[model samples]
Target: MSTMTVRMNEQDAELVRKFAQFEGVTISDFARTAILEKIEDSYDLQELREAIAQDSGERFSIDEVLTELD
Candidate 1:
């Protein structure tokens, strides 16, 4: 694995350290998880926007589906 360095103000760094300790994880692990989660959230939001844009605005209800099936 490659090592990465992050630069932050001392106050922010202390906050990260404290949060990591509170969560029982190392600072690196905490940062890695936080970064990956942020990326995943952004990807999901983009997908949702694309899906909404492509949507046809069709309406459906479970009862209608069941009636149609019958």
Candidate 2:
């Protein structure tokens, strides 16, 4: 495990502490989860954008697919 430190204003720190307490998690755990989730969301968005850019704009429906299979 590695330890990292972050600097924040007292008001922001207090808000994080209170919110963590309210959520029944330690400040460290809250911060870790939030940061990791943000990273995951960013990665997912980038992948979506790339997929859209590469898309061929083909159209299909479930009924059409089933008919083709029959």
Q: Give stretches of model 1 more than 4 Å off.
A: 65-70
As a whole number from 0 to 100, the lDDT of residue 65 in candidate 1 is 96
- Supply the TM-score for candidate 2: 0.84
TM-score for all predictions?
A: 0.86, 0.84
lDDT of every predicted structure (CA atoms):
0.98, 0.99
lDDT of 1: 0.98
- Candidate 2 clashing pairs? none
Candidate 2 structure quality by residue, lDDT tens digits, 1-70:
9999999999999999999999999999999999999999999999999999999999899999999999
lDDT of 1 by residue, 20-56 (tens): 9999999999999999999999999999999999999
